[model samples]
Target chain A: MLTDSERERYSRQILLFGEEGQERLKSSKVFIAGAGGLGCPAAAYLAAAGVGHLVIADCDSVDRTNLNRQILHYESDIGRPKVVSAREKLLSMNPDIRVEPLAVIISDNNASTLVSGCDLVVDALDTFTDRYALNRAAIRNRIPYIHGAVSGFDGHMATIIPGETACLECMVPEAPPRSVFPVVGTTPGLIGVLQAHEAIKQITGQGEPLTNQLVLWDGKASQFTMIRVERDPDCPACGGDSRASGRRREI
Target chain B: MRVQVKAFAGFREILGPDIALELPEGSTLTGLLEGLGRRSPGIQKALFDDQGTPLKSVIIMVNKKRQTRAEFVSRELHDGDEVAIYPPVAGG
Candidate 1:
């Protein structure tokens, strides 16, 4: 139930989306896999929008270096765990929304359990290993996963509806090698906002989700391009005849 | 054929922003990488593993589409394809 003050706070969005959209938000459970740059803003927006439940999982702690783009943390949160700090900020943003902080690194062993309970999963993680793990879990669970990545001035986003669209593995068969890369704080924030937008679209059943498509933004050129992604018939995660798999034919 | 290469982030620091390479018409992905390495040894260190093999996480996308590490050798090239090499950077 929405309190009078709460109702007033969200009146604008409610007016736009209507009571049904608000109810959909209230009933949604979203899992955010990282609490750093992208996760910070993504979680903030979702919480502010009154998402019913948000599960934040991250193993790292706030460091001085994270201040540039990690909006959920502050100077005071340097030593605090990311999930804890993120939850604190998110709860404060909207006390009506339930925030669950899982202060642990998501691994192959626990990915399924972590993603099983959520309606959607957001891959804001910083490593390909973790992203691949989450992708596998989301595919197996038949849940929707919003993928976002930023490097320097470039960022990419995609929405994967398990068994209905191309899984992450379909695009990149193997993980890219990790490197000490460069990034501006705003890069992840921009990509994170897009991820949240896709999530909201999925939740409210409004707009066309980027299913089987990759959206690339070249900040240097200020150009955006959308490309069709074809699912590989051999994608181990979503290829076989399983309940979680989408349509077998190519899109 | 001469193709221009743009390296980003760490690669940029080592090799500057861009470089031009001249290769044979039938040069494969591996061949082009080797040619670049010969011209600028710095790129070799950044792009190859300890064994001098192309780094796995280092993505080589031709014209913005992803190409497999193995495909680098056999994947045909056109006259003006922009080959982008990227080191993995995790986003938030």
Candidate 2:
């Protein structure tokens, strides 16, 4: 049900991708697991692209430090919960899309339920524990997950299509230790844009997604490299008698 | 063989962005970290744990392929494999 203004507003993108792509975007449900640096731009682009529904999950309040790269928030939003602010910004961008703001930290306990209903999960979260939890949920639910990470000038992105490609656990067995790390807001912005690009590709079946490959970007060198990832047969989540195979392996 | 090492986050501030290292033909990831510690004492605190072990969160990737702490010592390196060392940073 595109109104005259709605159709006209999206006319250029529609002309390039056609009504079918637009419809696919309109029907897809995407879950963004964080509302910070990467999540803001990624979710914003998806909403603007007409994604039918977006569930933004986060428990943190906005801080002044987030202003540099978190394009969805304003100075007035500093003390507001990121999910609340993100949803408002997204809905303001495109009211046609449904926005769900879950102001809770995504953890092992709630990841399955949170991820169960979405067509795809976007790993915009920063912590390794949450990323691994999302990886497990994606594998258990048999859904595709787009992974992104950034530290300072470097960032990386990958797409994991469970049972079809390698999961994040197979690529890195352990999470990096949590510490205060440096980041330029633009790093997440760069990676988030790529994540959104891959999500769209997954939705419309347009281009080749980075399944079983890690795309690394070194902003210092201005270099982009793709590392081929092989599934570890021993991966606990996607390997052996995991649900992906419909059996249980002794842990 | 000499390889170029790039450290990110805290490592960048401690080790000064990049360094060149000369190692034996079969240096492990542990060996490289030890070498780095010797060359730059500032990196020791950021790269090692209380028990003098490499921090688990310090990601060691050779040419973009991730290597576990155990594999760090056993994984062979070619002439131009760029080893990237990263500290954890959260992204929203």
Candidate 3:
């Protein structure tokens, strides 16, 4: 049941999703990987929206260079761990919610444990080396994964539900080329919000998820295009016999 | 045959939103990409490496339908087919 304060605090969104939907938000827990550009906005929105629990994991400390995009970290946070800075800000944003910030890198061995009881996972990490680990963990746990990435003025996002749609590997079969990539803050800002929007829609049952449609945002052309995607039966990750446990079934 | 090529991400900066390419009826998707390279050196450099091998990260689709990586070299284009190329962004 919503306390009087929750009812008051969420009044605006409640007008949108009603009290029952707000309860869903209050009960759901989300695992957000990374505390960088994408993760910053994603966490902020989800936190403000009253996602009951958020487990944010990142190993790096804040750098002077991160201020251009990482909104959660301030100048004083330069030497602080990303998860620590993010957690402090997020808790202040809404003390009603719980934030569990893990100060560690997410890799192959620990991905499953990190995501362990969470309702969903947010892929806001920059590197595929870590993204793939989270991907398999989401699959193994039978939870939905919101995938987003950005570079310069370009960004893309998709919702991955194991067994029901194409996994990350099926879409980005190989890791993309690496470089000292350039980005304006707005790229991750937009993509991260879209990811949070997808998450809210998923948890509240208010709308359809992205499913097989990949949203490619071209900030240069100011174009948002939805291209169809599908699973590869031979995809090494979520393919054939190698697939992790399927979706959380209805039964 | 004229095919509408839609480019996204880095490719969009080079090829704009859409470019109409005239290809021989039996041209494979690879051939069309090579044709695009011939049309613009920017695309040539972005789509290929120093040795001219196509970058595996470039995703190709037909009429908005994603084609498997192997189909990139083998799939043939038809008149009026919408071919989209997306070089996905890797950074956050």
Candidate 4:
């Protein structure tokens, strides 16, 4: 039940989604897998939108170089864990929500446990190894996952509804080697916000998520393109006879 | 056949947003990619390795439907078809 203060705090957005939707947000638990550029904006919006619980995990510290894109970490936060800084700002931004910060790298060993009880998982990591790990864990947990990534002026996001849509590996079977990729702040900022928007829709059961299609953002031309993604029978993650995947999702 | 090609991300930077390519009446996706590769070495380097195999990391779609690398060699393109190429980004 929303207290009087909780109702007033979310009155503006409540007008758009209504108290029922707001209550859904207040009851959802989200697991965000990074505390960097994408996570910063995604978590901030989810927090501001009054997601009842947020469990954020990241092992990296706030380096001076992260100041440009990781919005939650300030100059004073340099050398601190990214999740710690993010939790501080997220709580301060909306004291009504619960934020759990995990200061650890998301690896194959811990990924499933971290997301065990999450209603939804957000892939904001910078490496595909971690992304793949998180993807498998989400499948194992039967939790829907949101995948978002950006490099330079380009970024893409997709919503993965386990047993219902294509998994990340089904779309990109391989990945580019990890390196210090170049990225402008707004690139991830844009994609991350879209990710959070998708989360809200997924949580509140309000609108369409990016399921079975990738929305590619080209900052150069300021265009958004959607491309269909079909389920792969051999997709090692959510495929084959074991997956129980449904009919092909349409646009 | 005339195929409308759309490239996104780095592919867009090299091949521009959209390109119209004139090819034989029955052209394969690999043929279209080779045609694209002739215009920019970046396309060749990003989409295919030294052995000329399509990189699984690069996504190619035909008429808005995603196609895997295995499908690239066998799938034939029709005139007025829309082929899109993308490289998934990996930064947070």
Candidate 5:
């Protein structure tokens, strides 16, 4: 049921996935956490790709320091909330898609509600404190979570499907100590696009997801390595006896 | 016995991509790490803290399987075994 304009807008990618795949993109809803470096590019790509709805949540206002990597925010948006800045650019990028920007922090209390009814969740947050909350919510909701993080010239990403693969806790058992991490913009830009690529493939049924595998990107050496990973039976968040709702659809 | 050591990210800068460590047969994981420390002080500092304890955040894997901290200290390395060590990046 694509309109003539919808068909015209997606004509290029349609050559790759066909009209059916484009419809999948037009019907999917994605919940992206954070509006920082990783989230910025991820939202931009997913928005342009015509994901029907993008629910982006963030609490911080734009700072002068964020310009190096947060592409969605401009100098004029210096003091605006991140979600507000991101939403403006995303909507303008593609008016065909819907953008729901939530101006609030995602914590243990609100994580589940924020992700409810979404087809997938993207983990673009910086701290494990908030990441873990989204992890728990994704696990409870049985939604696939695409996890990505970058530091300096290095970055890593993986997809987590509850009950089928290693959850985030199984891979990163303890949170690393937080610090003022130094980073160049390209690292996040690359990893974020990889995340968006995974999301598109997941929704369109085009390719295999990076499940039970961790992709490590070392920009300095210009190398990509895949490390096999597994679920921990005793993982506190997704351990034994924690059942992913059987009714939930598999990706 | 010969074991392969693979390092990623910052560790690669110190130990290169792969190092073949010659160890006496029956060396435990701790012994091998300590031997590596003796070979390079920079790696020792990155892998361990002031008290010589392995940093809690650095992940250690054996033949692509993640090893528990307790297992890391107790497991023995055999010939041709591959051990990986790296810290997961936490930016963006």
Candidate 6:
């Protein structure tokens, strides 16, 4: 149920999706895994779109170096935890929505609990380790997960529908070595906004999510390319056999 | 046989967005990669390791379908096949 103020605040977008779709956004709970470059833009858009609740989890603090891309954090928030900085901005951006900031690292043990009750999970983390953890949790919970990453003016995103679509692990079976990757703000900014767009479409059932497809964004060439992907039957994450059991232990 | 190679991100920077390569019929993906590596050191370094094995992290797709590293070395290419090579970025 939208309050009178809520209906008025989302008037512009309401015209697009109607009051029902606006209410769908009001009822959705999205879990964002990072407050870095990708998370900032994703959360901002969802908040502005009137997503009912956002659970943003991050352990890092806002640093001077992060100011270039992590848009939610400003100069004044240099030493504060990223979730705190992001939560403050999101609430101020749209007081109608609820923002829950978790100042904790997302790990295998905590991933499931943190994402509890979320209608969707957004993978905006920089490390594949954390991304894998979130992937497993989403599969276990049977929730859709949106994965996005950016580096050096290039970024890619894919939407995972648990058993229905290729998962993050299924697509990238091996984790790329982690390092201090170079990136321009626009790289993640573009991809993150696309991710938010996918999320909005998902909650309101508006448009096609990037299901079974990887959308690569090249900032240099200024092009978006879609590649078809299929779930791997041997994938350790959501393979056909494992899909039946819903629990498989790695030997 | 003629095939089109579509490389993305860093690969595209070295080899351009799309390159037409001429290879003997039934040439394997490894052969195509080796041919690419011979053309430029930038692509060689990006796609292969010092030991000459395809970097495990680089993704190779044949006609929009993924080919794992093992399959990549063995899968034979046909005329007009589209091979996509890219390194998935990790930064947020």
Best by DockQ: 4
* Ranking 5 against 6 by DockQ, winner: 6
Model 6 CA deviation exceeding 4 Å by range: A241-245, A249-251, B38-45, B49-53
Candidate whose TM-score is highest = 4
Find the 10 residues in a row with the least total lDDT in model 6 chain A.
A242-251
Report the Cα lDDT for residue B82, model 1: 69
Task: Give a tens-digit lDDT track for model 5, residues B1-92.
Answer: 98999888777878898889888988988888888888878989877889998876787888877777788678999999998887888888
Pairs with steric clashes in candidate 1:
A38-B92, A124-B92, A163-A245, A163-A246, A176-B57, A177-B57
TM agreement with the true structure for every prediction: 0.82, 0.85, 0.92, 0.94, 0.91, 0.93
DockQ of each: 0.35, 0.43, 0.79, 0.85, 0.67, 0.73
- Which regions of candidate 2 deviate over 4 angstroms? A1-6, A240-251, B26-30, B45-56, B68-70
True contacts kept of 6: 0.69
lDDT per residue as tens, model 2, A182-208: 788889999998899899889977878
Candidate 3 local lDDT, B1-92, one digit each (tens): 99999888778878888888888879998898788888777889877877887876788889888888588788988999999889888887
What are the per-residue Cα lDDT tens digits for candidate 4 across A18-49? 99999999999999999999999999999999
Q: Provide the TM-score, chain A, model 5.
A: 0.95
DockQ of 2: 0.43
Worst 10 residues of 3 chain B by lDDT: B48-57
- Order of models, best DockQ first: 4, 3, 6, 5, 2, 1
Checking candidate 4 for backbone clashes, the offending pairs are none
Q: Rate the local accuracy (lDDT) of all candidates.
A: 0.81, 0.81, 0.88, 0.89, 0.88, 0.89
What's the TM-score of chain A alone for every prediction?
Answer: 0.94, 0.95, 0.95, 0.95, 0.95, 0.96
Candidate 6 lDDT for residue A75 = 100
- Candidate 5 residue pairs in clash (backbone atoms < 3 Å): none
Compose the digit string of candidate 1's lDDT tens values, residues B1-92: 87777655456567666677776888777888887777677778777877988876565667766666557888876667667665545555
- lDDT of residue A15 for candidate 5: 94
Q: Label model 2 with its docking quality class.
A: acceptable
